[model samples]
Structure formats: C-alpha cells, structure tokens
Target: MGFLSSLLGIIGFGIGLPIGLLVGFFFFVYSKPKQVQDPVVRPLEECDTTVLPDLLPEIPIWVKDPDYERAICREIRRQAEPILAEYSEKYKIKAIEFENLDLGTLPPTINGIRVYETNEKELVMEPVIKWAGNPNIILVLKLLSLQITLQLVDLQVFFAPRMTLKPLVPTFPCFANILVSLMERPHVDFGMKVLGGDIMSIPGLYQFIQVVRAFKLMKADFLGLSDPYVKLNLTGESLPGKKTTIKKKTLNPEWNENFKFVVREHQSQALQIQVFDWDKVGGDDRLGMQLVPLKLVTPHETKEFNLDLLKHTNISVHNDKKYRGTIVLELTYAPFREDSTSALSAKFDQMDSIIYRSSSNETLSKAGLLSVLVEAAEDLEGERHNNPYALILFRGEQKKTKLLRKTRNPLWNEEFQFALEEPPLLDKIRIEVLSKRTGIRFRSKESLGHVEINLDDVVRNGRINQKYHLINSKNGQLHVEIEWTMV
Candidate 1:
C-alpha cells in the first residue's frame, strides 16, 4: 500500500508541472509591450528647423543651391581641407578672380603683362576667393600669377613650392602654385607651363585641423573680386554707365581684369621697328616699340584707338606697278575675356599695315591666284583670327619674286629663261636636273651639256671639247650654282 501511494504522488506532480508551464507560456506570449529607455521620435513642437544647411561650414561655396560648380567647389573644400591643414599655421588662399582684361587687335609680349598698355610695365593681379574653412588649410593652397611672351614665360605666386613667402610679407607665411596659361584666344592651353613643387606636409591629423582654423581668418579673395567687370570701349566713347578706363596718365590698373591669360601682345607695340630687306630690326629695347594705351577721355566723349600716323614717309610712283614700304602702325590692346569679340577688329581700318618688301630667298611660287605661295611668313594682312596659329618661316635673304614649283620634269633641255620684272639680287641659281629611270652620276670629268649665264656685265658658256664635268646625268640631281658677279 506504501509503494502504491509514492507512485501516485510522483505521477500527480508530473501532470501539474506540464500544465503550469503550458499556461505560463501562453500568458507570456500575449503580455504587455516592453518600453525603450530613450525615445527616438521627437515631438513636432520641440523640433528646431531655423538654421539652414548652406550656413554650415561644409557647404561654404554654395551661395545658391542650384549651381553645380559651386557645389563641386564646396565638396572639394570639404574633402581636402582636413588633409591640407596638417603642416601650415596660417590660412590657405582661396581662388582669384580676373575680369575685363583687354584683347585689342594687337598681340602682347612677355614684359607687356606688367602694365595695361605696354609690356614696358608688368602685370600684377590681386585675387578674390571667398570661402569658409579652417585658416590652417590655406597653407597648402597657392595663388599663382604667370607672365608670358611669344617665345617664353615665367610664374610668380603667393609662396614658393617648398618654401614660404614670409620675407615678402613678414607677418604672413604663404605658398602658391604658379600656373602659366598659354591662351589661344577663347581657348586656354595648360600644357605650356611647368609646375613647381608640392605644398606643406604635416605628420599628425589633429595639428592639421588647427591649420584650417587659421585659413578661415584670411579673406584675401575679397580684394580681387570687389572690382566690377570692365566693358568694351566701343563708340570710342565711355558708356553712360561706370567708367571702365584707367587714364593713360594715371597709368595704373583701375577696374580691369581677366582669369584666362596668355602672354601680353602689346610688349612689342611700343618698340620702334624698321622693316629692312623683309626683316624688322629695332634699334634698342626702349626705341624698339611705339605703343598707345587705351583710356576714357571723358564720360560722354569717346575715343577710338585712332592711329592715323604717329610718323611716316611715302614714295611717289609713276608706273602701274608700285613697290615701296608702306609704314603702318601696330595696334595692341586687351580682350575682355575668352570668347570676347569686340567690333574693334573689323576691316582694313582695324588691321595692321606693314611696308611691302622683297628679298632674294623668298621666291613666291606662281600658283594660287589672288594669293601667292610665299616662303617666309607674312604678317596679319587681312582679317585676323582671334586665335593663335602656326607660322612657317625661312632664313637667307630671299626675293619675294615669282618662281616655278620643282616638278618631275626629266626632259628639261631647253634654257629656262626666267624673266624677272625687276633685276634680281641673285646670289645662286638652282636647276632641277632629272631623268626618268636612269639616275644621275655624282661627278665625272666628262662634260655632256652645260649651262650659260649672263648677270648684267658678267657672262659664261658651255665648253666645246674640254673634259666634260658630267654631273648627275646618269641618275637625277638638282644642280644649283652661286651667281658670279664679274668684277
């Protein structure tokens, strides 16, 4: 009876445990929600939406929301600022604004960039770049200015590559990358220049942040951008609006600038040039050019770059064909910017005129009607293009006379009598001797047929029975000889 009672108790306990666990599980499954310690959803009444994102330092360049370039600049500043501030203590320089620089028909020179009118003066730019970032980041930044010419160019910057410009400005330590811009009118060429070196290199990240703080304090770009865009002085009169011209007497950079720059075109304008024998050779550096600067005489009264004649001389001819040096002035001025077209360069009145000259070497081919095929380069005679182009030049004193093209004429046996309209200053006569299949022999002491010449009083003829100097009669050759003046 005791064993049966123990067994009954165990069975009853097992049955109660399973039932209790099942009931508790069902109750827990349908229980109340568990509360979060901190609520993430903010109440609408307490939300603050007064400050705008553009006001943030990360979006400094975006003055307007839609401009893509502004957005890109902002992003660049945001990303590069941290890495730049590592080494420098002072601020990084922002962008520089160049506006209303002139491109008056004439080309400038290397030195002319110094002043507005003449390469005699130099070009100096004050930039304007507005941004909000750590002033320290300015250390890695550069503000470069390049001076250019037809042959070569140089660069100047806020700072050197590896070194700072503290000596130039004792209080400030800055560096820049001088970028030389070789401009072909509306287009700018970057491959023409050479970059100096890299900026400051810092070791730690926290130190770089301090450098950015310093850059925020320097607002140098404001100095460059404050000036207005200069307008073209058409009508020879200053427009009724703002006076853009800086007086020639004042001789200073007033309110005029441009960003894309090549070398100056006016540097050679002031030079006093004399075209002798188809070559222009100036006396000295100072007397080499003759230049006139552009300026506003009065607000209402305008002035065209009227170059009637500073000084000149003419020739009196009595024949149908005329030949003389026609002294013409060279006009050099600036264009407003890239793609800028002012009616300044219109027709013959706007183009430069050079006195016509003929030389001994430049024998223009008698082809291409209206325009002859010249050897040496001709200046901008007709309507000139705004862009730069290639020029083919030749050496030796050559005449701008008519000549035949060297064609493969093997049976040129008859004496090619070249009748010059004028007596040629002949130094050498070139003959194209050739054969179809048989090549001309180099040099043998056997004469076949020869040449005859007569220069005014001098004369010579072919030999009869003498040992013939049988030149490239076997193969082909171009025989040329110096003109002998019989003394």
Candidate 2:
C-alpha cells in the first residue's frame, strides 16, 4: 500500500508539473493588456472638391422601348431588395426602406455600373456617399451595400435610362454612386460556393461557373505521317490556348484530352479547336480547325459530338463539305445555382427555337444601339509631324474622327453611334489611325498603326474603357470605350 501510494504520487507529479508550467506561461504572456491606438480621422473638404461629374448625362441616351426598360428595372429592384436586407443586418444598420425606391428615379449612367448576373464572382459595388448638408446626418443614416444581378437567363442587361436616387437623402445632401444591374438573358449558373478557391455563390456572374469538356482526338486521317496534337481556344481575347500531348509519328493518332473553360453566355460564344502536326525541325504544321457553338450545350447533361475538322479555305463552305478528319468530343456545363433565400431568384425561359442566340441576335436584333467613344491615342511612332485621324469600322458601318494635326499623341474625345438590328459578335471592330500625307501631293493617307478589338468583349463586359496595343507597330496604344444598349 505504501509503495502504491508513492508510485501514484510520482505519476501525478509528472503529469501535473508540465501542465501547470504550460498554463502559467500562457496566462503570463497573454493576460497582459494590449495597447489600443486611436484611429486617425480626416476632415471632409467642401470647396474645390473634385466631383466626378456624371459622365452618363453628358452623353445623351435614348431608349426606344420604355416597357423593356421598366421590366429590367423592376427585376433589378427585386433581386437587390433581399441582398440589401442581408447587408443591413450584417453591418448593423437601420432597415433599408425600399418602399419608396423606384426604378424611374435611378441614375441612368454607366459610371461605376457593373452587372453581376452571370456565374461569375459575387459583385459588390461600393458607392461612396458624400454629405451635402449636415455632417452629423451620417450617424443617423446607414449606408447600405448594393449588389446588382440580372434576373434573366441569357445574361443580357439593359443599362440605358439610368435610375436616380432622390429619397435616400431627401433632407440631407448625400451623393452615392449606386451600382445597379438591368438584365436581359442568362446562361448557366450552378451557384457553386467554391471553384478553385473562387466564391461564386451568386446566381448570374459567368465567372463563378465553369464547364468541363472532353475531346477525344480520335484518328486524324491526314495525308502525311504527322505527330498530331490539338489546341483549344474560347475565341475572344488572346487568351493562352490549351493543347493536348503530342502523339508519336502516326497519321491516325488518338488523343483523348480534357479541358475546362469559364462560360459567360450560352449562344454568344464558341470553342475553336485547331489541330496541328508536331515537327522537330520547324514550326508546327496546321492540320485543321473546327468551331463548336456553346449554345448547343445543356447544363448538367453530357453530350457527345463528332466534329468534322475543316481545311483552310478562302471561300466559306458549310461544315458538312469542309473535311480534314472528325473529332469525337463530350461536353458538360456545370453551373452554380443558389438555393432559395439567396439574393437572386430569376426564372429564365429555356432557349427554344432561338438559333444563334447572342447579344447581337436575341437582345439586340429588334432595337440595338452601340456607342463608341474615341478618347485618345498615345505613343504613336512614325514621321516627325504626324496628323492622326481614327477610322472605326463595325460590320459594314464605318465612322471616322476629326483629324488631330501634327501631334504624336492625339486626344479626340469623340462619340460615334451605330444603329443596328443585329451585331456580328464574331467579327472584329477595326480601328486604324492614319496620318495624312505632308509631301507634294499630300492627298494619300499612311497607316500609322491599327487596333482590332473583338466585338464579343464589348458585348460581354457592358462597357470597355481601356487602351489597346496598336498592331503592326513596336509602340503605340489607343484609348477607346464601347457601350451597348438594347431598346
């Protein structure tokens, strides 16, 4: 009994000693008070305050279809209300009273406007509000976060006739850059919470969802012994193309390759597959190319297709006649659809009888308008004194800006409007900046440099305001903005 008692004491000491030391150290280190620093507060300035004047109002916009615009505004408010409710609770703010909120009063401008109605990332538009009257009014008024989404399936949105907000600051002078969305159509949104670390819980942003497609590059019946490999592209910007592993020296090479692409809209885009023959000596030889329209795919269902590879031809031939070989492919579109109680619950009509549905076709065909603002050009290279003028081309319609004389950098803040029923999304908008001749005749025009922008980018991104690198030159860039409106 004495030995057992002594042994128990030793065991208890062994265990308790270490634990006591650990606890002592933890409290000794963590129990100390932390120094809290006072936050620096900056006073708001009044006089000479640079207000980003509503750029939308300066450009007068006309909407032909008032009913369509009203429908879009109604949908936008519906989707935004619940989102505002969540924001109000999370931020501990007063209940957002949208009973007085009307689409007729919302600002109709492209300034700080973003559409979050695709399978893309969750759109959080932060509109900064400036107090025009009582500074202390900020304490009483709670600023709510605005999230914009489209209620349509095809992911189309009407952005004209911007809504105005007046009741939010009826007593106080408050200016907020409210972000709202007016939608038309949608594609696929599975409402995924995490995709490769992306939070795509939203209903409509295209980037939130992805499509998995498999290509069975079964036997290429080429004329020669070629090491065949396949390259896939989404056919928009110069995104890096995907390629399959090269199969060794056989004309009939079978390459089963799988690839994934982020889809924006259904019928507005296509996947371009180009087969090339691998070579050790020189550049890879072009075997054949084929295009698969994205509109043919159904969400959550796998479909197989035998696509015929077509040889390069100057004349346009039907897909049946154009042949190099056939590629057996399988594709599945995985979209993220948020469950009920989510911010967006837009019911879209399934696409039926709509052939070649695109922003140019389904939405823009009836009443479509395109506005191109030619802002400026920088770092142009060529002669010492170059008089630069811009030639803009879309489909068959062409417009030119007034010439800016004898300057390497030209600033022509000009806007051109294109009235159209259907726009060709596959075609490129050609912009060529030319310099008038200075010599004896001085009548001929010289191509300083040119920029070709894919119209699909303009259609997808709502408004494109960026500088494009000039082609056929080492250095030069053109600043341009494109806005699309559907009446």
Candidate 3:
C-alpha cells in the first residue's frame, strides 16, 4: 500500500508541476500587448517625374518647340506660381497683381546703355552685350523674365524682379568680373529647400529660382540701332608691300570710270594690319586666339587687304628682323555671322509675323524681344558638304581632349554641330576649318602675336580676281566667333 501511494504521488507531482509552470508562463506572455512591426513608408515620388496635372500649362506648344527660351519662360510661370503659393504661405504674404513698368532701365551686365523692359517689378532684355575684352559678346536673355507682386495684408503691396543668372555666377562674384552684380543672392537656405542637395547648380538653373526680380526698372540700348557693337580702330599701322613710298589709287576721266590703285616700285615689304574685333557675337570674350599657322616656305609673302569683310582683319607691322613669308593681319572687327554665311541671306518679312507673345500686360517677356528675333534666321544655312559630313570638336587644343571621331546630328539641316566631350577642365576649343567645293586651300596656324589664318583659293584665284571678291561671292569663307561661359 505504501509503495503504491508513493508511486502515485510522484507521478502526479511530475505531471502537475510541468503543467502548472507552462500555464503560468502562457498567462504572463498573453497579459502583455502583442509585439507588432512598425509600418514602412514608400519614399516621396521624384519631383521631376511628379505629374502635377496643373504643373505646366495645358497648352504644350512651347514644349514641342525646340527653343529652350520659350520653354524656360513657360517653366518659370509653371514653377513660380507654385513657389509663390508656397512662398506666400511661408512669408504670410499675399501675391498681388503685377504693376509698374520702365523700359529705360539697365542692369549691370549692360556694357553699353542697356535696354530693359519690366513689369515695374522685373527686367527683361532682348539683347545684352558684355565686353570681356577681345570678344565683344552679345547676350539674348533666355529666361522667363518675370517680376513678382506681393501683398502684406493691406499694409502695402510690393514687387520684385526675378534674377537671370547662373548658380555659381551669383555665388562667386569677384572671380568672373561680370558687369551685373551677383543677382540678388538667393537665400541659400530658401534655395536649398526648393532644390534638393543632389544638384550642383551648373550653368543654367533659373528653375532653382534665385534670380531677383525688380518692380521698378530702367533700360537703354548702350548703343542705339545701327550703332556698331564692335569697331576696328587701326591707328598707326604698317601695310603690306610698302616702305616709305605712298602708293596712290586714282580715278582717271579718260579711263572707263574705274578707280585704280598702284603698288610702289621701290617698296617690297608687306603691309600688315592689326585686327581688334569683338571676340564673341554674344557673351563675354573669354576665348583665347590660337594661330595654327600653315607651314611657311619663305619669310616674306605678299599680303592683301579687303574691306567689307564681315570680320575686321588687322595686319601687324612686318617685323624686318625676324621676317617670315607669312602675311600678317590685325583683326579689328569681330565676326557677326551666327551661321557661317552672311547675315543678308535671311530677311525678316516685316509684313506679317508674331512678335513676342505676352502673358500679362506686365509679362517680362513681351513683343520687344520677339520683334528683334524675327528674320534672324531668314538667311541662315549650315556648312555644305558633298560626302558624309563628320563634325569635329576639341575641348582643348591638345589631342588628348579631342573627340577622335564625330558624326554630326543635323538639327535643322543635313549638317549639325558636334557636341564634344567636355574636358576635365574646360581649357580651350579647336575646330577643323573646311572649304569644300570652293577649291580653296585655307591656311590657319595657332601661334602667339604672329597669328594669321589665310584661306586661299589657289586654283581659282589670280584668274578670277586679285582680292577675295570671288571668295566672298561664292560664300566659301566662314567666320569664327568665340563665346565664353563660366561653368
């Protein structure tokens, strides 16, 4: 009986102990809240791809157009309205209607008298010229050109002009020495809030919207209509094929109404002219001249001169000591042609054309700029080639930075400008000059001081005309203009 009782008690304790422990453990665990993982958030969609149905205007005509200028303006309106909406909220200000206008205002970039138009809040210009020495460059402002209007809750209404400047240009003012002051500097914090950190403001970042606009403004054409933006002042220079004897060209009554000029009998030295022309048709003259001279056989080549050349050519005084067989020119006039051809090729039809399209009566972009742009491309043409055309571009003069092989993508024509790989540091630019079908051997050499580039139609010249009259007529000669941008 004792053995039976003991065995039974031991068995009961063994089973009951384990069961009691398990029950208590389960109750303790269940008493507390169940553990749960936190919810994750899908990151905000990218702003670039963020489809704001009301973001851009319903009319996408500007987007379809290849011109970024129009697109930028529309983008300004698209972007500005929202920012202003947010800006008003942040500053606790109401965006009021635009007001005030002055056309006789000028911003700093205007080297000469600048012509500016504004909604009394912002300044927009058709053409702005900034002379950075050597190159007299023109700038056609490609921006929304808008001014702003704000309200301080019945206290006062204010207006501001949006600035038109690149990011770095405003940051480091003294480095470039540009005419315009650092555009009303962006509150970098404000700018950062609008533009994310992923971007380093490159050349054109108006969308980052740092440009300061004006409410009251004035603009003037530093130089009026027909006033030459560039000029050649040839003062006290030597001419080719002359010494002390003055050769004279005279009109004879007996001759068939022709004027004749004669070279002196004793003078054998070549006359050289020094050309001082603007470096760029637009922008600053940051381009450095490199005279890649063709191999010269002798130290003394007969020189020639011509008037009415698009670019002013200057000839240096022939150095008698280290005489070379190359004719020297002093270039005083800058090339004005945008396309290789002459400007007269394109004629604007003044009869019927839409000038600048306006948004509001106070729109910064208006009829003025549009009026000037008309007929700019009437006569423009690309480089003509018979065979497959390949475009070549060099970031620097060195072959290392050169694009070994390039094929152009024709923009509007069969010929397209080559977009070269940017050099690690943008140091220089070199391009291959071609004269096809003109049967001319153009010689260009990059050198210092003694720089001279000559295009000679060896086969056709001498039989046709003594001067470049034939070359000019065939449109065989192309001009090169340099422009500068601070990246």
lDDT of each: 0.24, 0.55, 0.24
Model 2 per-residue lDDT tens digits across residues 236-277: 634566678887766556665566555545557777777887
lDDT tens digits, residues 1-487, model 3?
A: 9999999999999999999999999999888777999997454365433343335444244343446554554565566567646645543444422221111123224422334554443343333232222211111111233222211111111112234322223232312222343322211100001101111112110000011111111111233111111111112222221111111221110111111111121123122222121322553221111121211112123222221221222345332232111212321111111111122124323222212111222222111100000000111123443211212243332111111112121111111111111211223233232223334545322111111213112111100111111121233222222221111
Each prediction's RMSD to truth: 32.3, 30.3, 26.1
Of the pair 2 and 3, which is ahead by lDDT? 2
- Give, for candidate 1, the lowest lDDT window spanning 10 residues: 206-215
Candidate 2 RMSD to the real structure: 30.3
Q: Per-residue lDDT tens digits of candidate 1, residues 1-487?
A: 9999999999999999999999999889988878869867765446554334423534333432535544555676667556545322332334222211222222222211111222422233322111221211111134344221111122111111121122132221122222333221121111111122221221111000000000011111224211111222222222131223222211112322211111122222122222111112432111011123322222223233322211222224232232221222222222211110122212112212211111212222111001111111111111211111111111231222222222221111111122222233332322221112123544312222222222322112110111112233443222222221110
Q: What does the lDDT read for residue 238 in candidate 2?
A: 49
* TM-score ranking from best candidate downward: 2, 3, 1
Which candidate tops TM-score? 2
TM-score of each: 0.15, 0.31, 0.16
RMSD (CA, angstroms), candidate 3:
26.1
